[model samples]
Every structure is written in C-alpha cells, then in structure tokens.
Target: MNAYGSYVEFDRARWAALRSRTPLRLSEEELQRIKGLNDKISLQEVEEIYIPLTRLINLKVRAAQYLDEVTSAFLGCEPVHKPFIIGVAGSVAVGKSTVARLLQTLLSRWEHHPTVDLVTTDGFLYPTRVLEEKGLMARKGFPESYDTKKLLDFLTRVRAGERQVEAPVYSHVTYDVLPDRSEIVDSPDILIVEGVNVLQVSKGQPVFVSDFFDFSVYIDAEEQEIRNWYIDRFLLLHRTAFRDPSSYFHRYAELTEREAVERATNIWETINLLNLNENILPTRGRADLVLSKGPDHQIHRVFLKDL
Candidate 1:
C-alpha cells in the first residue's frame, strides 16, 4: 500500500479533535516532570499522540484475551492469559522512552488492570567487552552488534509467562551494556519494549523480533529534524549531566565547548543518523502505526493500518 504521503499542515485544534475520546495516564507528578523537560512535547501531545494509542492497545489486549477464552472453551480447558507485548521503535532522539514510560503508568492505572512492565532493547545489547571482542564496537546500535538470539529467547520466555526472567541492563551514563547486572521481570499484564530497532525483522527464515510483538509503533520524523534533535540533546546533556565527574562521558565533558560541539555533531552525522537511515527508517512502514513528527518534534501525522 502507498502509505507515505506529502506532509499536510494542521493546527493543534485538529490534533486535539482527532485524538479526542481517549484516556491519558499522566499523574500530576509525571505531568510536571514531562512538562519541565519537554516544552515542545506537552500534555497536549500526550493526549493527541499517546492517548489514542493506549486505547488501541487496550482493545488489542482485550481481543487477545477474548480469543484465549474462546480457544480454551473449544479445547475444554481453562483460559490461559498471557502478557500483551507492544513494541515501540524509532530513531535515537525520538522520545520513545517517554512513550514507553507513559504507557506503563497509564496501562497499569486502567481500572482493574494488572501491572505493566517496561523494557528497552538497550538491555539486550552485547556488553561492551563482548562487542569489542566480536569486532562490533563500531557497529554498536546496528543489528549485527546485538545478541539477537538471546533477545529473541528473552521475549519468547516472557511471552510464555516465565516465573522469573532476568534482562541484562544498560547504563546510559557509562554508555555501555552492563556486564554484571540485569532487571528481573515478574509477570505483568502488559510489556512495552522500546528502542531504535525494537521492531526489526528477524534474520531467521521462520521467525523474527516482530513475530513476538502483539502490536508495534514507529515514531517517525524527517531525517534532518531528527539529526538536529540529536545534536541538541547531546549539547544539553554535555552542559548538564555530562559535567558530573562520575559521568562516563566526563572525558568528553572536559573538552572545550567548541570541541564537544564538534564531536557531538560528527557523531550525530556519522553514527546515529547513518544507523537510522540504513537500518531503522526503512522499517517505519512495518509498524501498525507511524507517528510522523515535524520540525517541532511533535507528531504531525498518524498513519494507521486500515482495519
């Protein structure tokens, strides 16, 4: 299907109406935090971009449950409920983390809903040492650098409702996958997997990462705008968090402001932008929904599969 179209301009009012009739998950505290960090992405964006999304996902979950009940009765057995998996994918600076975090809070607070778990594919990244040993350090965010087999196994186990499963952790400050630590997943009613390549196609002939997803979303934006956002975020982090002596990026932080800006721009142009174009952007069409963002870093278009 020819899903891509020229970007149409619209005002916030249109967005609000289109995204109306949905519930939001933000508590006053969470709303304040989001508001403080993201002036561009506000409560309105959540109402428009994420609220309708949650409603769609909730229906998907309830439908899956209904199917289980039907199948169980057909087989003369009790219903077997499983967690609903939602995979959110996008470029590095696309705010997918916020999406996952928000959904976790909202989905859990839904009347009588079970716990919602959030995980990132970063946790499944090969540890720095492993990547270095395998000659994949330069290809860090690329698919080849990941332990795809292990990630698949983790999802397979989670889908089957494993009693206790541990997911390796990644430290943003260190900018490395942790070698010795992981987060434990007790079963939850819902699981949200967010990352640049979370929805990537599997190389195996018979199955892939997407095979495990009940629903998937692609956070979309123009290449130039995304690149700019990445650079902006890098600069912001460098001036703030990166200044901490204990920060893993402290060495970069110690550089002259000009030097740091040069390095950040170069990395954005060479690594992240390249990865998004080569590996991630092509998969946007694969998502059940595509949230196309404009220069302002707010959603401008929503392309959903016609049911």
Candidate 2:
C-alpha cells in the first residue's frame, strides 16, 4: 500500500486481491439495471472493484453492530435497532447513483443485512416553483437549493430508529419535488444515501448531512473525463428522455445534434463544472474511502482512510 496523508492508496490489482474469494452474488442483468446512463460498469468491474469494497463494508457493518450490542449491554439498556448508514458522494455524472445501488444490492445479499434501502438527496431538493421564487432555478443542485432542515430532520428520525419515516420525493419528469408524494423508509439493516451533496458540510449548521453517515465514499475522476461523461449523458437524454413530452427537458429534443452538443457543453461549463470545482471537489478528502476512476469509467485506484 502507498501511504498518502491519512489514506492508504492501492492500485487496481492490489485492491482486487482483497476480495478474498467473496462470491459474486450479482448477475449481469441486475448489473445492467443498476448502472446509470453513459456509465460503463460490467460484471468484471464489479468483481475487481466493488466486490472487495463490499467485503470491507460488510466487515465494518458487523463490527459496528457488535460494538453497539456490547455498549448497550454495558449500559444495562436494550439494544436499539440502528441501521448502518452509507453516504455516496460524487459529481453530477460520476456514477454516484450507480455505486449506491450496487452497494445496496451487494450489501443486502450478505444475509446479515437483507433489508437495504437506498435514498437520494434529489428527493430533498426544493420544488422548481420554490427555486424559481427564490431565484435559485439556475443554481439548482447547489447546497442553497436544498431543503436542508427537512433533510436533516428526516435523517434524524431515521437514525433515531423511528418507524415508517417518510422522505419527500422528486420527479425528473417535472423537474420538481412531488407535492403529494413521499417515500416511506421503514427500519432496515442498512440505508445508502446517495447524492451530489451527501458529504457537504454547511457552515453555521450544528449538524451537517455527513454527520449522519456511518461510512462515506467519494467517487473521483479527472475533471475533463467527468465533463465528457456529463456531455455524453446529456446527449443521450436528448435523444431519449428529452423526446418525452412530459420531460422537463423536452425542448432540447428539437435541437439539432450540433445545437444539443453546444447547449450541453454550455450548461456543463456554467453550472456543473462550477459546482464540482467550488463545492464538491473540496469535500473529497473528507470521505472514508475514495474510488478514483480512469477515463474508461472504471475504478483504477482506491484510497482508503487509515484507521
């Protein structure tokens, strides 16, 4: 292992060796369904990168449970059911959602944690109407655009082991929070919180979002690679989702290929790139583990915080 600051860095081969014969529990079809658009993830990628990562996470979860149990017995109180929380953070098109889903699936299959739930910070974003009113429509996905209090309260309740906790839902079709809809999260063995802002530490807030995370992962890649991925995703959406009449980006479907590419590039430069540089990238060092990807969209290096 190569020591760098507080982390121990491992190349792909070294990291893959840590799998320790952990059986691959995922099928190809399932992997396809879990991957995000324009994100390249294969069964081989799962074996080499994610399987070992899941093994590490499984050990962490078991240890946490044991510690909690021992502490409760020492305190002469019944052990409370507390789900292990994992936070997945990355830039807009860096495949944060895909990683989150993969972890949720793999972690659940371990049998010790069969009920894993996945939640995205997208659900906590303010409605488009609210954003427009606050003049934050252009700043959507920025920290100020979220309902942090509501998100904190939701996380607080979940961590408190409250039953049937509800979180607000957002719709990409309308590009807004669904006023009448929410997701009910019952007590589970693990909850994977995924989003661009999962690791953000807001100033003046006594409790930050990352405070609720038991484990956090940061997906890392070179800025130019991420920009290209974002553009590719946008173009794919323009040819597919943007063509749907109800999609928020339906107007983009009418643009010529050149115009679409120009629009996507402009948005990436003005909004996504700015957010990544100013806010998201700065938080990478705070993560417990960093998965650095190569231009091929596969994790090439793993930087894990030393205990």
Q: Candidates' TM-scores?
A: 0.91, 0.98
CA deviation > 4 Å runs, candidate 2: 1-4
Counting clashing residue pairs in each candidate, in order, gives 0, 0
Give candidate 1's TM-score.
Answer: 0.91
Question: How do the residues 83-190 of candidate 1 rate in per-residue lDDT, one tens digit apiece?
Answer: 888899999887777767777777777663468888899988888888889988878899888788888898889998786788889998887877888888777788
lDDT of 2 by residue, 196-277 (tens): 9888887778999999999999999999999999989999998899999999999889999899999999999999999999
Weakest 10 consecutive residues of candidate 2 by summed lDDT: 1-10
Stretches of model 1 off by over 4 angstroms after superposition = 1-25, 34-39, 202-205
Q: TM-score: which candidate is best?
A: 2
lDDT for model 2 comes to 0.92
